[model samples]
Target: LNLVDLRLTGTIPPALGKLSQLRRLALHINALSGTLPPELSGLSQLEYINIYDNKISGTIPSELGALSQLKELGLDHNALSGSVPKELNKLNKLQLSACELGGT
Candidate 1:
């Protein structure tokens, strides 16, 4: 399914990463928390992922690099900490702010 405009609440379900056919996942402006599920690395076809304006915490998942096709990623205004995953350097367009980005 070509679902757009996604608004997820609570912890991000690991099941979402199983949607191999998913191309664009937009989960902005929600109350999502907890560490980013490593399972998300399974979405091989994912091109866009926006998880801005949420309470999500923890370091950015390095597994996200598995999305070879991912173009844009938004993780602003969250409780996320730790250094930006070096893997994220491959992303062409990413928006992350107001979070610590240099630590163990």
Candidate 2:
């Protein structure tokens, strides 16, 4: 589901992980807060996840590395903290942003 640029509010529901067939999820440019749901790692078929330009905080889940099919992960301009998970390096095709987790 592509929910980008919707100016959405609130946090991402962990229940979304139930979408086992999901290929792309874009929640960028919204007012959503809270950490990325580690449950999202359940999306084995996910190819892209764009949640940039939001108010979300917390660290990127290392479980996301389970997405062998993931190609891009955009988490820029958020309040996220911590270093990028080395497990993410396993994504050979991943195009990540703001994973450095410097001062927020």
Each candidate's lDDT (Cα)?
0.83, 0.84
Model 1 Cα lDDT, one tens digit per residue, 1-104? 32223555679889998999888887777778798899999999999898878889999999998799999988888888888887878888988887666664
Local distance difference test, candidate 2: 0.84
Model 2: worst 10 consecutive residues (lDDT sum): 95-104
The alpha-carbon lDDT assigned to residue 70 of candidate 2 equals 91
> So what's the TM-score on candidate 2?
0.88
| RMSD vs true structure, all candidates | 2.5, 2.8
Root mean square deviation (Cα) for candidate 2: 2.8
Candidate 1 residue runs with Cα over 4 Å from true position: 1-8
User: Which 10 consecutive residues of model 1 have the lowest summed lDDT?
Assistant: 1-10
